[model samples]
Target: MTFEIAFVLLSLLGMVIALILDKMRPGMVLFSVVVLFLCAGILTPKEMLEGFSNKGMITVAMLFLVSEGVRQSGALGQVIKKLLPEGKTTVFKAQFRMLPSIAFISAFLNNTPVVVIFAPIIKRWAQSVHLPATKFLIPLSYVTILGGICTLIGTSTNLVVHGMILEAGYEGFTMFELGKVGIFIAIAGIIYLFLFSKKLLPDARPDTAVPDEEVEDGEKLHRVEAVLGARFPGINKTLADFNFQRHYGAEVKEIKTRNGQRFVTNLNQIVLREGDTLVVMADDTFIPTWGESSVFMMLANGKDTEPVPGKKKRWFALILLILMIVGATVGELPVTKEMFPNIKLDMFFFVCVTTIIMAWTKIFPARKYTKYISWDILITIACAFAISKAMVNSGVADGVAHYIIGLSHNYGPHVLLAILFVITNLFTELITNNAAAALAFPLALALSQQLGVDPTPFFVVICMAASASFSTPIGYQTNLIVQGIGNYKFMDFVRIGLPLNIITFLISVFLIPLIWPF
Candidate 1:
């Protein structure tokens, strides 16, 4: 074993342990590993920090602002209201009418905002139509995830993989290149939900429905949901033992586990886990005080998450988004290249222009633009690039790839591709999709090189696998968002999502290679 290989192995082991121990953010863990490599003379200062300035990373940052603009503009809400058929009265009919449209819209928009805007609307509408909201909510999240895989910018994971591709000196994905296989997955997923979902999905999660009573002034009681993080020192203790109300000045109504199990009536019996989410009723000050606290991994209340844009501004924001998509798509054409030989036109150019215009127009409170960006995610992605490089530099990626090839030699690249898909999907389920893609990309590239085949199929599989997270609410952000709002149980996700996961696996393994010709 060479010194570089040994050092890389130790660094990877330490990272896994640190992440599993839940002590540090992924960015911090990866950055610390890079520091070790730098100190040991394994990598130079420039190479170690190059990811911070990476074009793909910066593009992701810019897209955050762009998505924020659309979210705040209220265009998504208007579109959903218009698109949902007025006469749909049953869960099955409503799903048939809505899921495909949601999937199509989600292919063009960010999944979180789409879920945030649509989840409440769907729940209210389901109640009005005498349907089970639990039926449509999980499908809402699942379809958005499926739709997001169709476009390069649909999920941050896609862009992260694209960034890795560019960093590895490969051609990056085009605007709709992923649609080739992604559309099939989305269509199949929608069919599955339409046919089999009503039987499997839960009818209700206890205490998920909002309380009906309002104040004399017609204002709703402020109900906030928060998850305990490192800041709260009361892990593994009951609420009675911990004195919940005295410390936080809030009344805990229910506790939702990470897997979506809810303890609605018993607040004192169940012990608290660090990531356990408590649905509490408190005054308006709860969000203001604990919003930025490290004690809460998440703090969410309704309606105040983003400001609603007026009708005119909403239309303007929608137009800006459409132009960005169109410009980016058209810019990739040969005719456009011929027309503008000296200048470049791509998704990056359009996204940059859109973000700047939205900021200037104050589409989403330009003064606090940085607040909208998830700094933790950006940091994680930047560091992930460096970590992938370290693996390649130390030969760790190639070594692992060869071992897998040695074991699966008889079945050839098809088996290796399937293994990659399964591994990447499991990682996405356990960690963030962007992190999963980053960790899997280096090995995928190494495996392709070993087999002397096109890496396109491998890259496509990674893109699909990382975004195909199901079977758990924690797997995807959209799933988590809907889980709380819909009052879902853990088994609800497992029953419906497990089938979808299997479907995604089969389609990706069989369909991706056909399109990319590995």
Candidate 2:
């Protein structure tokens, strides 16, 4: 290997190690790698920073605002209520009823917020009806992931790949292009969950249902459920360190962690994490006080949350979201493309328009817009583009592609496709999905060129594999959200999600080339 290629490979190995160890935020780790590339002359200054101005990255930022608008409008919360059955139901029946629709809804919104909003409601409903919350929570997280793969704007990873495609001078994916293959995987995966999840998933009994009338010292105490967000000041700190009761005026009664365990006895000593769920005892003001706060992703009282936004505002937010999706879809059609040859009326344009409208109309708090977007993810994506460029620039991607192709050339591209899928999926399970796609994109691009085949199949596999992160809770943020709420163990995810992961893998390998062609 040339010194440049050797440097890029070693740097990438270090990046992966840093990401896996989580020694720093993913964006910073990636940004550090890009800077190193720039210094080594592997990437020009413009090439290193081009991702900051890339259309795909900006679209992701806008979608975060759009998602926040819908989340604030209380529309998703209402939808979850309507989906759950009114009475006691079997695990299969409950999953069958909500999983598909949840997947569909998730296709249009960010998966994390979708899970954040729905998890508490579903958990409470399952307990009320005598079903295990554990049965439905993991499925809820999995379906959102399934749904995210259905659209270009479904997940940040799709937009990241789409950005890379545009930068490479190829026609980027349409809003519904991924849906062609994604729908099948989603349907099949959901069916797999419906069939096996009931047996494979553990059934952890929820804590005793909280009573509405817990009179203590002649004062009424209400049970408030709060799912900690990244912004929570006390993350990685004990309750005593943060003075949870003194600051929030709510006494934490039980703490559930992402490892599928709970700490009720040593609440004061337990260290807090982003996805931990806390059942606290407080007065009526608990929900209203922290309802819109950034510290908690979701806060609910008993089985319900505070009143949603005004009906008119809720309807307007929903309509705006629908219009954005339809507009982006139609813009990508050949007829529309021909009419607007000079101006690309695409997702980026519609999202920009929708975000401004939502801000002006106050769907989400406009002034606090900065808080809605995950800057870390955007940084990670922009840096991802830079890092992918470095790989291509250094010839490392081509060298690795040739090595991989040599191993499987006799077996044909099908084997190559499967191999690429396994690598990307494993990385996603170990790190973040966007980071995985970033690491894999250049190799996939080079492999197609080396084999004299269209890169479309390779591109499609990257999208699918990077998103099929079901084997572990840490792979996807949605899984972590549900882990604590459901009280699921690490092995619980392995048991059920491993099978679903395999199902998605088989579908991607056998089905993608047929649709996009190699």
Candidate 3:
């Protein structure tokens, strides 16, 4: 390899290590690598900053606001409650009723918000029906992931790939184009979960550190579940230093970490991290006080602490979401494209309109709009573009692609596709999915060019492999949220998600070529 290629490769290795070791936030780690590329003359300043103005990254930012509007309307929380049957039910029955709807909902809204809203409700419902919360939490996370693959806006990674494709002088994906393969994958994966998840998942019960008894002031202590977001002030600090009770007027009863450890004693010694679920004991005002705060991605009452939102607001928010989806889908039609040649009525356009309408209508708190957007994720995606560009600029992707082609040429493109899928999937399971896609995109592009085929199939595989993050909590943010709230061990995911990962791998390898011809 040339020195520039060697340097890019080594920098990527260090970036992945930093991400996996939790040396810093993922956005910072990725941004650092992009900066390194700029300093090494692999990228110009404009090239490095191109990602910040990417269409996909901007769409992702808007979707976060739309999701926040829906979340604040309290419609989803109510819908989840209705989805769960009240009477006695089997795990199969409960999953059948719950998982599919959630999958569909997540296809339009961001899956992170879907999980943030649904997890606590499902956990509470599971307890009510005398079922294991652990049995359902992982399934909830997995199904959302499956659903996200079905649409362009379903997951940020899809949009990220689309943005990269556009940047590469190809047509971007339509709203439902991914659904062709994504639907089958979702069906097969959901069926697998329905059949085996119950047997594979653990039966851990919820552990309440403090009882719901009355205190000296004749006030009842309420249990509140808070899933820490990237903005949590206490992240990386111990309770002794942060003083959780003094700051929030709530006592940290316990902390459930993504590593699958639950700390009920000596909690002051443990360092906090994003995606950690805190079981807190507070007064009646806790949920109302911190419900809309950005520090916690989600805050659900352990009991019914607040009244459900009005039917009107729920319907309005739902309608707005539907309009955003349909408008984007129809605008991409050839007829519409011809009608509005100068104005592309794509996801970006519709999302911008929807967010502004919601803001004016007071769907979500408009003033605190910054709280809704996860800037870290946005930064990560923007830097991902720059990183991918550096790979292409330095010829690292060509070098690696030729090496892989040499190994698999004897076996033909099928083996090559499988190998690429495996490599991308391994990176996703170890680090962030967006980073994984950025890392693999250039190689996929080079592979298609060397083989003299359309890069569409290779691109599809990257999307599938990148988003199909299973077998580890750290791979996806949703998994981390579930791991903490479900109080599961790392082995719990390995036991259950590993098979699903293989299923996704098999489906992507066998089906993508059929859908998007190589």
Q: Against the true structure, candidate 1 has what lDDT?
A: 0.83
Worst 10 residues of 3 by lDDT: 300-309
State the local distance difference test value for candidate 2.
Answer: 0.88
| Candidate 1 regions with alpha-carbon error over 4 angstroms | 85-88, 208-249, 264-277, 283-307
Clashing pairs in 3: none
Best by TM-score: 3
lDDT of each: 0.83, 0.88, 0.90
Poorly placed runs, candidate 2 (over 4 Å): 208-221, 238-242, 265-271
Model 3, 457-508: lDDT tens digits are 8898898899998899989989988887788889998998899889988988
Candidate 3 deviant stretches above 4 angstroms: 305-307
Ranking by TM-score: 3, 2, 1
Please write out the lDDT profile of model 1 over residues 154-225, one tens digit for every residue: 888888999899988999999999999999999999999999999998786545654634657775557777
RMSD in angstroms, candidate 1?
A: 3.5
For residues 1-518, write the lDDT of model 2, one tens digit per residue: 79999899999999999888666668889999999999999999999889999999999999999998998888898888999999867888888889999999999999988988898888878878988888898889899999999999999999999999988888889898999899999999999888888899887765646565555577788877778876788887899889999889988888888666777787788988766889888888788788777788777675566358778878999999999999999998899999999988999999999999999988888889998888889999999999999999999999999999888879988899999999999999998999999989999999999999999889989999999999888788888877766777889999998888889999999999899888
The candidate that achieves the highest lDDT relative to the unseen native structure? 3
Write out the backbone clash pairs for model 1: none
Query: What local lDDT does model 3 show for residue 60?
Result: 97
What lDDT does model 3 reach? 0.90
